[model samples]
Target: MNFFKIKTSWSNAEFILIKLCMASAYILVGSYFHDFFAEYYSILIGIFIITAIWFVYQWLKKMKTHSDLPY
Candidate 1:
């Protein structure tokens, strides 16, 4: 009976929307940069994007495991 007592707010939805918007903006910017840079150094922009993503993943992993805070 208690299973239906859950409460939720729009905070999570808002957060997701904001993240989506940010990701869309990032995609546009990345594409522009990729086009601009690929003309001069082919594949350099892609490599840069991959490296940045890798570092962000590593940082997130470290923070998740090294902190006492709850996820």
Candidate 2:
């Protein structure tokens, strides 16, 4: 399944707000996981950081989107 093909009814700000909410929820759950399995903390943090960077990149790219239609 392609993720980019999925359409959302939310505007950019709403979408960013939802993303922040989801990121915080993941951090909360991830902290619990880290507490129980401390050995994997580095890997878990690495993945989280990478995913956060990817999200920011996608958001920036989306914001920079432009139309080439004649004015």
- List TM-score per model, in order: 0.38, 0.46
lDDT of 1: 0.84
| Backbone clashes under 3 angstroms, per model | 0, 0
The digit string of per-residue lDDT tens for model 2 on 11-44 reads 7877898899999999999877866878887987
Candidate 1 lDDT, tens digit per residue, 22-66?
A: 999999998889757657664676788999999999999998888
- Highest TM-score against the true fold, candidate: 2
User: How many residue pairs in model 1 have overlapping backbones?
Assistant: 0
**CA-only RMSD, every prediction:** 10.1, 6.4
The regions of model 2 sitting more than 4 angstroms off are: 1-35, 66-71
